[model samples]
Target: DTAVSQTPKYLVTQMGNDKSIKCEQNLGHDTMYWYKQDSKKFLKIMFSYNNKELIINETVPNRFSPKSPDKAHLNLHINSLELGDSAVYFCASSQDPSGRPPYNEQFFGPGTRLTVL
Candidate 1:
């Protein structure tokens, strides 16, 4: 069984197009998150959801919106995809809001590589 799954592992498209990435987790966890890894490999948290509540990180752009259909799924929709949005999108989950330990240990999916032309 897949612990986590995302569609269109590799997305290539022209700028200004809208795109979406879907994520689901079978783990009985209360929280899920979306992270974006830039070209430099810097991982940044975009949005987090737990128990149907949305917790968005301030640095995330308005163009990105995260939707959680249920406790088990959180999907990301991007409007007017830009060249700068070309990065690896990763979906992760945690057991609780406190995170794993001193730092949150998130179980991540394979990742979605988005390319903008």
Candidate 2:
């Protein structure tokens, strides 16, 4: 079984269009995240949800919304999609890290590539 899964691995749309990507994980992790990988291959975290609240990176635009209906699912919604929004988005999950014991690594999905025309 796949640890993480995303629907519509590839997305193509014109500028100003709206789209949404769905993601689900069965890893039993407490934290889920949304990451964006630019054309240059630079990956950066856009949002993180730790079982309850969401932590968003300040650099991310308001047009991008990440919704976590539950601990095992995270969905991304983009409004007024622009050329700059064209990139690969990844969903990742990780258990809570323990400084007193050990650390846990994050598991990411294959990625959803969005192309804006």
Candidate 3:
């Protein structure tokens, strides 16, 4: 099986609807994360679940919430979605944080495109 995978590759909804994006990673050794890629191709981490704990990136807005049903599953819920919230969400997994490029290497999932109208 692949290291990471996500569901619902396309999501289109109105501004006020609530939605959830699911992500699963064959994660271990404290290295799995969620990131958002905007239309501009800027990538930013939204959350990281490492060692069975959930860590949300401080830069992410409160509307974006990461729910970890377990150590290996990381999901996202967006409340009161807005037009600006549209983006491609990706889930990724790695082996560890060794402060090197190899350790930082991540196997990414097929992204979910969420378009809020």
Q: Tell me the lDDT of candidate 2.
A: 0.86
Residue lDDT tens for model 2, 1-117: 999999889999999999999999998887888899998998898888878468545478899888888899989999999999999999888886332324358889999999999
User: Which pairs clash in model 2?
Assistant: none
> Relative to the unseen true structure, what is the C-alpha lDDT of residue 39 in candidate 2, on a scale of 0 to 100?
88
Clashes of each: 0, 0, 0
Of 2 and 3, the candidate ahead on lDDT is: 2
Q: Order the candidates by TM-score, highest first — what do you get?
A: 1, 2, 3
TM-score for model 3? 0.88
Please give each candidate's TM-score: 0.93, 0.92, 0.88
lDDT of each: 0.88, 0.86, 0.81
Model 1 accuracy (lDDT, Cα): 0.88
Stretch of 10 with least lDDT, candidate 3: 49-58
Residue pairs clashing in model 3 are none
Q: Which ten residues in a row have the lowest lDDT in candidate 2?
A: 95-104
Best by TM-score: 1
As a TM-score, model 2 comes out at: 0.92
Q: Write the per-residue lDDT of candidate 3 for residues 1-117, one digit (tens) a residue.
A: 766779888999999888999888765546667888999999888788776576547588788888878767778899999999999999887776454876878879999999998
